[model samples]
Target: MTREAMAAFMFRMDGTSSYQAPKVSPFADVKPGDKFYREISWMHSQGLSTGTRQTSGKPLFQPKAALSREAMAAFMFRLEKPKAYQAPKVSVFSDMKPSDKFYREVSWMYASKLTTGYKAPNGSRSFGPKQSLTREAMAAFMYRLETTLRLK
Candidate 1:
């Protein structure tokens, strides 16, 4: 799903059925009256997102872009807000290095067993950070996250 759809889903899951759009949108692309505007705004207000980029001094949400696996990892990590959490010193996935953006979040997901990643032919695991997250993958991630939350 697109980032905006995910944000809207997350907003509803957080028990926010309604929200008022911010007077000045945090995202340059998400203006008032736009689809998913209130939900995206709520996501930003709740500190779940800060948008994808900045253009002309305004944050850009890239609402229509497909959500990537690494991006999902970041979102889930931010939503959980684990206190005093630290990323592993070494890389867990063959495709991702410790120096990569979102590496900490993806590593946290692996450490938490929220994801096992795909097993490559070489027997090493790959996180596929740039891959678009499939619906099934998204559901699995959310289910694991919810289950983890319940246990905690």
Candidate 2:
């Protein structure tokens, strides 16, 4: 599933399905003519995603591109917007360090038991932040999220 689809599904699950606003759509690719236009626009408005391809001056959501683990963590973290965010001292995944872009979010995900990531053959765990998010993985994430929020 695309990031926009994930955002829209999450928004729907959060009980905020109403399209309320003078919608602000920054990406030219996701127009009103598109299928997930409103959902993508809403996600952007909520600050869950900044989209991709910004440095080129032509921002693109890359809607068809696979969503990364780090990006998913960031999305979940932003969606929650915890009352108090404290970064963990120790890293849960060997691949994720404190200096990584998704460090804090991944830390929160780990602390909350939202994800366990993938275990390597060497007995080390890797978050695989750059890997593509699969449908089953997204479902698992959403299940954990909804259960945690008691939204089910």
Candidate 3:
């Protein structure tokens, strides 16, 4: 799914049956008339997203971009808004480094037992941060996220 679609799905998953569009969209790419404008606006208001980039000093949401696994992790982590959460100093996966943009979120996912990553033939695990999130993976993540939230 696109980032915009993910944002909208996550918003609904947050139990929002309905929402009103903000007077202004914080994203340069999302206009008031855009299909997911209200959901994206709500995400911005809730601190769930700050957009993917900035152009001319205005934030661009990159609504049409495909959702990556790491980005999904970040979104889920933000949705939980865990308090006093600290990412591990050591990397949990062979591919994910501490310096990566979504390291904290990916680490949090492992720490929270939301994901175990994929094991390789070399006996190493990879988070596949840049990979497009498959529908099955997304379902698993959502199920795990719901379970995690219920336990909290």
Candidate 4:
């Protein structure tokens, strides 16, 4: 996907169906070499993200950094925590073993029907985790997440 496409994404919050502000733009043009590459602590302070990968205190927004399967799951799940959630028990993909930091997030996505399965890395599953998610997948996932929130 193109950077422009990623930049177009508008993060939405669940429950009341409001949009949670996104801190970073996937577009190269949108990211200036400044606070955009701050640490997860900054993301938390800004309510824009929940830093994973534990990269560094200075984890960049790297907007085009293709959304991984687990990453996407976590992203989707994170958007819907307006109330308490039990999350899901893993019983689907074997490739998704435990010990993965995103295990809980993956389960949440499955339980909520936000995701069916992980897309293959070779464009087989549409958009692989290593690849940036298309505008379509983002919308679908967010829509499902919002639906789950409403049901709660």
> Candidate 4 overall Cα lDDT vs. reference?
0.49
Off by over 4 Å in 1: none
What is candidate 2's CA lDDT for residue 106? 87
Q: Write the per-residue lDDT of candidate 3 for residues 32-101, one digit (tens) a residue.
A: 9998888888898889899857547768889989899999999999988889989888897999889999
Answer with 2 or 3, whichever has the higher lDDT.
Answer: 3
Clashing pairs in 4: none
Better of 2 and 3 by TM-score: 3
The TM-score-based order of candidates, best leading, equals 3, 1, 2, 4
Model 4 regions more than 4 Å off: 1-8, 12-57, 82-90, 118-132
Q: List the residue pairs that clash in candidate 3.
A: none
Q: What TM value does model 4 have?
A: 0.56
Taking the tens digit of each residue's C-alpha lDDT, what string does model 1 give over 28-124?
8889888888988888888889985754677888999999999999988888887887888878799998899999999989988899999988899
lDDT per residue as tens, model 2, 1-152: 67767766776766365775334457856766577777777777888877777766747887777788888999889888976878877787999889899899988887777888889998988888888788788889889877865453
**Candidate 4 per-residue C-alpha lDDT over 76-136 given as tens digits, one digit per residue, 9 for 90 to 100:** 5554553565544544655554555767777667666677766666533221334456668
- TM per candidate comes to 0.91, 0.85, 0.91, 0.56
Clashing pairs in 1: none
